[model samples]
Target: MRSWGKSVDTMSSSSRSSQKENVSASRFGPKLCGYCNEFLSNLDLNFDQLNICGWVHSMDYHDIHKSARSGCQLCIVLRHDNTDPEDEHWHKAALGAYYKGRASIMMFLKSTSTTCYSAMYGQLSETISYPGTSRRQRVLDELDSIGAYHDLNYTPPKSTESQTAWELCDAWIKNCIKNHSRCKILHSASWYPTRLLYIGHFPTGYLDRDLSSFNVQLHLTQDKPPKGGYMTLSHSWGFIAFEMLKLTSETYEYRIKNGFSYIELPKTFQDAVRLSRFLRSDYIWIDSLCIIQGSEDDWIHESKAMVDVYRHSKCNIAATAAQGPTEGCFYPRDPTIVSPLEISLRLGGEEENPIPKKYLIVSDHSWHRSIEEAPLNKRAWVFQERILAPRQIHCAKDQLFWECNQTTACETFPFIFESHIEYSKGAAPLALNITSLDLTLSEMRKLRFCETRHDPFPGNFISYPQESSYSTYSNISRFDRTLAHLEGATIDEKIERLRRNIFLDWNNIISRYSSLELTYKTDRLVAIFGVASRVQEALKDMDIYVAGLWRSQLPWMLLWQIRISDTPPSYDCGPSWSWASFNRDVYFYAIPQPHDRVLINVDEAHDGHTVAKQGAASSHRISYLKLRCLLYKIEPDIAANSGKQSRTRFTTPTNPRLGFRPKSLHTDCTETDDYWHQAYIILVIGQHEENRLWGLLVRLCEEEPDCYRRTGMCWIDTEAEPNITEHVRGATDKDKA
Candidate 1:
């Protein structure tokens, strides 16, 4: 990204001129004496003016004509006043001329000044020709003459001796330790060859060789032949030493009192020491160096700590990579295959000029198995003696195979809902509800049903819950009841009953529906009805019900089914009584009967007077039915409030019955005249509240004609006499008629 600004081209010409002039007069430019400057000013200078005169003549001319730029010689006599005080412009002009290819002019200017080479180079590069090689060489030589080369290459190599393989490996190990301080080290047989060759099986030829002889171990069995040519004698020696170091470091620390010892040999030991000096270690405990290898007692005693040495080391550098194919090394070969006679003869010391070979045996069976199977075989064989016991290898492999099979089976299993449902039914009811009962049941039945008709196991399976709730009622009681009830009932009747029942229950228990107050122990059961109740209450409150039940820790309600009307009706104007429009005027049938009940009468205009007429005129009866329907709708709220035991006393509203007195009434009527109407309203409200108190009670008794509970009842009304009277007085008698 470029800097946030316009380019320098946006600057005015005056600003550019000022910048040029400032640059010219700065000390960074070529230094010039007043005489030289005067000479330049007097000359009818062209770009090549400096080249026209000889150096000596130019100098002489500059001294005489230095102040001749002014017209009068007498003006030059007034030394200070005659000289141009604002010489920046002239300096800039000189720079401009140099930049315009006046190399000789810049050279002339530099020759007349006492500036250093660097300053001359700077001015030339900025205003004239750039500094050439000769100038740079002079600067470097000057610095060298003063002796500053010591800081250039501070550290130097000690010697030119070539590093042996063992030395290189040891150094690499130390470097690894310094870099990674927290990695565990492990090793195998190749890491302890010296001890193994001495105590374990080895060819007589190898054993009888002179102690100083470096011979690589070789394998005769045929498989893939080792990759490289014969190993060198010197490299074999390095391998032995490397192995010895690993064994000694890993095994000797715990046995000896001083915990330090050295391997001693005549010429061989001396060469090993010299070669080992090239190696480095941050903290190594090589077994040969750490234990008195020559002493059998010490070796036997110290060998016990070998496990800790390898296990605790930052890293182990095994000589596993040291040997190459064709080298006579102890490379493990497959036992099932036999080597050719010629190859065996070559590997053995049969030939007149036998070549030495070193082969890295990956394992005893390198080519018999696939790449995927190789690791298991190697892990089993390599660590058999030190880490794994002979008997455990088979068991370990079996376990590994079993686990892999199990994983594949799980992934490939097919989903069957019937089988799942069957399985769920077989399980304990509590457990079923607490888990994926629906899914389990569905899958059980699906598997069974599918299996009877076709294959039980499909190619693959993905299963989810069949329904939100499947184990809420033990033995599927609720589902059975619902099915039975819907057998002969109309959809509208079922819906209306369900609505009334839910509203009454919820209204009765509304006060007790707080999340903080209710405690839900299990997810299954609570996810069903608990969720439903909260949703119903939230809807009634005239608040947008954003489902946050999951966000809350306590279970509130479970969603069953949400019904969205085709034409979205206003909340208060909905056909059914909603919680918000509970007391609003509306008419509905109580039980679909001709003359079932008259709950409320709001048409009577007499003050404190009301009439409850059963099977009256259709208009009057409908009007009365509307009031009763509205009252019945409000019952759910009352019932909902009553459900909560903690606040059961306050379940019903304080004013259960509402009475209105119109001002157009001729005379006030006694409470006795409207006793039935008032009593009925009170009775209905109280019964609704009671039903809400216990859903089961409402379910059982609500069907009775006089099922109202009278204990919890109260009344409230506003005085509308003034408004009624004014409306009546304003209207002409004919209008009333």
Candidate 2:
């Protein structure tokens, strides 16, 4: 067989599946049966309408689900578009569509079968680049290739543990190390973490080594920074009835000297050790083993430096596919599923390009499956681990993926979505474009294309944006674009934007980080403290971290509002003045009016955060926060207030006594409008040009002398009566925390 593969220029996104490769796929490509050929003939018609595909007669919902487990290529592709929770719906939809006999229905087909996809060329040709427009266009172009095609690969590897998988992984690392200078780390001995687990040298590869001889030991690195490079592990501890393996205060001394056997470690850790050794790294950091378990002081101290452990390491291994440690980092996958299916088309062409032919399909939701929708990415701590790590190898359910600060490449796509430019050896240095305007690190990260902003105030109640990204097509995300434009979503791209706003970026991070789940409520601030430290470092210490709010971004940061979630807040969190006080997500949704100035003065700001149980996490209750600001008694339109939370209009502009009619006011508590009826408006900002005011709705703190607790965020329309702004300033300033 003769083969020539060229790296294709592109972009795009999907769900996943696997299947046995069709014999002779390496030559003329898999021969599509007559049913698929006829089905392809009616490409425009939906699957349900394509009754010509007699294969549907054998199609069963249980078969699809069964095939999903058995590594059926087509079924896995369907799963690429779904999370586990949503899989049954797609399966049911396929069956229901079969019965309906509609055009909208062989369920959605792709390139792995008949239509040929070009992404695999990258892996084949050893090409790596940033995202651009070409890939998506190619994917969009190949949309019609949904047929019963055979695997492009000639043979299947034994499992993800095969030499083939490791070869692919090695290629990614080789390119990252040799080609990507940015991803390379220059570590001094000082960079080592306080503790590290030393997986004793394996002279033989893990697969070849005798299990009885393999040893593991705790290497306390505080006294001596190891000379060799190290790797880090990101895995789920998972819930269990009994205690899992760990280094405790009691075991600390014994673990350091005696070191347990390889069998003592969990399956995930063992897999990590194998990978680390395969990568030629002897030392690896695992949280539970490195940090003293059941010891709060040690955990807190080590957790504080968690950022460096990941950031300074040579690489981080993410067991992204696994739910718990028991699942391990590897799985036996059908090779055909990872390898795109192939079929040569007979459609007539002018020799340069083909005609009206549709063939080739893709799992557009691979990102959702391999990482975003994966179990590990959901953890709050993983966010920072992902962002801070210089590079990472994701052990996905079906395949492996590489992610670094520079780019992301999966086994399926095997390349990045970069603009395609023909290259030859010794070509002139490639010119990289740098934006002339000096953007802050945060500002630089926020410059994304096709991002949508939700209404700041929807109806009367504010609706918070969830973790979901805005999608243009149900299967395609806004991030799904061409490589030339870098429109495709990178794993960390969205979070990267949050790094830009300096102060505003922190708000974005809080909104994002706060939405994640935490096993320990007290770790709310602890889990994200590393990210905070990074943001602070970027700020060059321009802003002081007063609990969650920045001292400089005050008033704005203090305006963090609770999301309308059924999940209740933990009173154990920081002072009510900070967003960290809430267990559910809180958003800095209220934007200060244009040219708006803070009318409130921070008379006294002190961070008296004591640890929740007994330690010093950032979210501890505040020592003191006194804001001296004028308060004006305001009233809402009874009718508008009664109806579906409508905007309170300033109908009585003639009477200043009616006060500043709040354009929008949503209190944290829904139990009563009584607080709204007796609200005092404190000016957080006054926008003169816009004729609007943004501030907090507050009520007097009965016990405190001239103090108040924030009730809700208030936006007032001064257009009706501009003089109303003066009345707010005329009111007496009261201390508030």
Candidate lDDT values, in order: 0.23, 0.54
Count of backbone clashes, every candidate in sequence: 65, 60
lDDT of 1 by residue, 411-430 (tens): 00100001112212232222
> In candidate 2, residue 188 scores what lDDT?
27
- Best candidate per lDDT, number? 2
* Per-model TM-score on C-alpha atoms: 0.15, 0.70
Can you tell me which runs of candidate 2 are displaced by over 4 Å?
1-36, 44-76, 79-158, 184-190, 201-209, 341-360, 417-500, 565-568, 591-594, 610-620, 635-661, 687-692, 717-737
Candidate 1 weakest lDDT stretch, 10 residues: 402-411
Runs with alpha carbons beyond 4 Å of true place in candidate 1: 1-171, 181-275, 281-300, 312-737
CA RMSD, predictions in order: 40.2, 11.7
lDDT of 1 at 79: 19
